[model samples]
Target: MKKQILTTLVFLGIIIPAITAQTTSENPYADSYIYWDYLAAYKSGQATVAFNNIDAMLQTYPPQKEIAMPRELALVSLDQLLHDTDNDQTETFYTFINTRMMRVLKDLDRPVEKGLRIYKLYNDGFIIKSKKATVAIDLIPGGSNAKPFIKDSIIYGIAGKCDALFISHWHADHANLNIAKSFAARGKRVIAPKGLWENVDPMIQPLTEHIETDIKFDDLDLTLHVLPGHQGDVLNNINVVEFHGEGTVAQTGDQWGTDDLKWIDHVNEKYDIDVLMPNCWINNMKRHLVGFGPKMIITGHENELGEHSIDHREAYWMTIKKMELLSDLNMPYVLMTWGEWYDYQR
Candidate 1:
């Protein structure tokens, strides 16, 4: 009887803790509730329920790695569901995007310090705020489809907070006409390379110029150095923004460094890049960083939903492995997801 009671006590102890761990919010797997809920909703053809699940997951603010891994897997699974011919439930996919966009917009409205704070938006989109100005780059909705996921009101709210919009290229995933229109409506600066919105609207023409010239934003107390670059066969602009008191930041929008290192070599010589924002999939990244020599690096273009191909749909694990390879480069790099911000001091 003593041994029987002892064995029963041991079994109860293990079972109770296991059950608690599964149900408790403090458990690391608590976020998985959101993930599984979303999947169930997707399978049931309940778009609204799936979106609510995503919102709940985002609200939980799970540990960065936990959130990143499961969120990406869920997104990939969602993309497949949306593309499935038998599954006519595509509305949830858009809901998923717009809901997250609203969250990002709300986060942007938060009060920031006079020092530099960078927020990672969709894909390569980033919002850089400093004492003198709030600058937005590549601010657009994600997904391979051209349809806008974020509403006009949300775009207006984001534009109202920004002083300038710097588009890296003419790609749909990296550029938004509605966003640019909002900035222009406020009489703010919208800088880009030539051929952006050339056919869409006359008023939307970006302040295009040669890559070497420095464009000044007097109101923001900032200067932008547009460098000539390329994304595949299309013209891509590598923007190096210099804040009044803060150091400079460089963002390469999908640039592959195929232009014989012309712009990379030039920028390396001309400026001291405080933060280098590059695509996670850029080839020969070590060589490019070694040449430009940024003090710190923050990789972007992870898990671009717009690309239907999984090869282009990057994951956090891939970024970690890539960073490990470039660890020998001796540069500190950070990986950030949507609506996340990084504060940098000069």
Candidate 2:
């Protein structure tokens, strides 16, 4: 009889807690909410209140062991907010987030995770928010055949969570159909140049919505602007998208419009961009700077996994410095590679 009682108690202990966890999932940040709140608030121009709430939340849930990505993000976002403000405001916000809000997340079992990467312009995490809705872009690993991306997991993870994805063009260097499939499996809506979508595998087709012109998917708060790409064929539509509250970033896709000032100027005229995330090839970048007018520039389409393909790192730096030289004409330019996410202050 005693043996039977002990077995039942053991079973109950294991089963009861899971049952309890399921029954009490009332907390928004409980399981994991990709925090679009901070981004949303920033986009809506509610900087102070947004800062206050996020700060309070972080302070209440300070980092602990078993770190989770979302919790770290809350802290990172709080840091960015305070850093963007005046010194006094920064200190106050820091105290609020670190001391109060973070503690709460900690209690809820949300601790800051490690392995997040930072670049000049991008961040690695599970969520990307426009000024409006927030979407989850979780990174998944690819096989050895996968095209190299700097900070691979970080980039792919967020790409996976994107509600609307942007494929610059069809070069294997630019488009990873396999990666797109992962995002598709989760019901994400991808936006790519029409040509790429046509050639993309059927598995990825269901996940995409194509736009042929300069248009905005307002529901997603994304603006799709197609420009001349690397090869310059009608099928080669290089896209630059503006994520509403996250500021504007132009994806050169695989094409760099190095020879055409007119097209780059056209892009500048069409969008009030904060950063330009483009492929960093000299033929593309040099001519790109003449017409590229963004405060920051990020390099993409470079091999992140290999040994700095083509000694490309130095060339990327030189191109950025040239852009900064132009910034001396009043447009500051900073070059970044992968591992960055756009953050905006509405």
Candidate 3:
């Protein structure tokens, strides 16, 4: 009798609540909402208050893959508020995102004792730091048509912390002119493929298309081995960099050419790589994985994108699906959103 009573209590208190939250999420406009109050506050111009409520809810719900209820809804709601809004509210939405990112940027000042600490800011923008040096790859302020997405002060702050920046290609989403200029102005090395911003920013050095040369810096304690790549016809430099004697970390910036795979499929045979940050939608990801052979994969290029089309914007759940389908490979991976960090050990 006591066992039956206890089981009933668990069903009502735990299982029912989870099921209810899941059901409520399917109809976002339903009055039986988990986050309607916060969403209302944000739309009504109390963004700070809305943010506080959302933050608190995040703490309460926490985050998990399957069991966690309403966390996914909350994230989706916030993403919708940011992306689905109009030009009138652009500044407010931008402010909300930048505020969160400011906290992340400040946190980078704290030292990491071992391995690599990688921080993700919007889209494919990442800053990877080690005990010896900090390297930024595909660090954009946002897309060209929609930028000043991050404040100059924030971009400058990023430049202040990093020793160098490596841009992959000429696309504005990946190769931000202002971000590269900020790094270059600090007398820090900025390298990209040839013909990117040619004659415009003389300080932006172009990497030659040869694999033999290892790009090194005078004051920076790091080396970059290049893999000349392409996104269709666009030249992309896949950066395989080693910092502070740590494990190899490779950054693939929009590499999607079949011809590029001839070399990419052989990355593991060439060198031992610890971390590989690949775009979530890259072609033949399994083939790319075997080639790079990183200990773990932290995916990028989700949700936030350049174009106005909602279809162009990839969601975080897509990464989750990719991971599940690729479970056979036994490669460990973590899906990350904006302002998230993953510490990887060699």
Candidate 4:
């Protein structure tokens, strides 16, 4: 009887904990071990491992409110880890690109059957797909650093699905020569302002056109209205793309306040924008959104790792603050990390 009781106790101890663990694993936020493990891995400079923890936490796809605390904490941890320049810069860069950015690339490989699907790559980089055509705007890897985090093959794979590429400006973080070349090589249209790659490579020069001109690609059933805009004093092309029968989207690449409002107001008056994708840190973001009056706002360019200054290093919390300030505007806005997407329907 003593032996039997001991055996039963041992079985209960092992089996009960195993069941608990399995349940906790499915719901990572409830699993303190997983959270702490991720924090420890991140603090120890194990970016890959830390990112796995983030992935595990996000796998359940908890509601934004439910995941808010963990997500912010995770981003804060990553921001701190990346700022430790004493660590291996190359390793850190690759770790971010491989884990976060690569996940976005992988997600983009899926098909968009109906409606408009927007995938945030990095910074202002996005891939907007519809039943009509796949449009890639400002599709870049990560940053302008000498060491490339994302490979050319990855760019090619994304370009394979895109029917057109729209470059917002000549900034290294917003525009990639190799990515543009890949799209062109694939026999897709590459549209940008003149002098994008004037000195870099002659072969990669894009088809420049007037900013106010509407470039229509009937084959793809797409129409792009390239609006003349600027980021500070530098010329920036704000693209408004119409995916027929689905919806319309406007991507503002670092395009700042009132300087371009004349054209922005005109565009908004002319087109009913379903979604507006803008840099989260832009000056007077509320004013810009109000002028455009989009159905939805999705802000980007948070935590651009390429930037050297911590001030420019945006965080998820900053985005939250911006969203709060704009809360009274009576419009819905979404803040998505890399690899995340939002669907818009007409």
The clash number for model 2 is: 41
Tens digits of lDDT, candidate 4, 178-277? 7877776767777776667654444344446535868788988879888878887777888889888888898988887576776565566788899998
Give me the displacement of residue 111 in model 3, in angstroms.
1.1
Task: Please identify which of the two predictions, 1 or 4, would achieve the higher TM-score against the true structure.
Answer: 4
| Model 1 lDDT per residue over 37-113, tens place | 23444354455565566456644543242236655554444445444433332566556656666766786766666
- Mark the 10 consecutive residues where model 3 has the least summed lDDT: 33-42
Candidate 3 lDDT (Cα, whole model)?
0.73
* Candidate 4 accuracy as TM-score: 0.78
- Stretches of candidate 1 exceeding 4 Å from the true structure: 1-96, 143-147, 199-209
Ranking by lDDT: 3, 4, 1, 2
Alpha carbon deviation, residue 11, candidate 4 (Å): 49
* List of clashing residue pairs for candidate 1: 143-306, 144-306
Give candidate 2's TM-score: 0.50
lDDT of each: 0.71, 0.45, 0.73, 0.72
lDDT of 3 by residue, 1-346 (tens): 9999999998898877566656563434445533533444335455545555655565456433342546666565555554554422455656666776786688789897888888877768788888878888888777453456777677678767888888888877788777788877878888888777666566688865534347876465778877887899888888888775776788888888888788788889987888888988788888899899988888888776446476657676667777878889888876556666777787
Question: For this target, which candidate reaches the highest lDDT against the unseen true structure?
Answer: 3
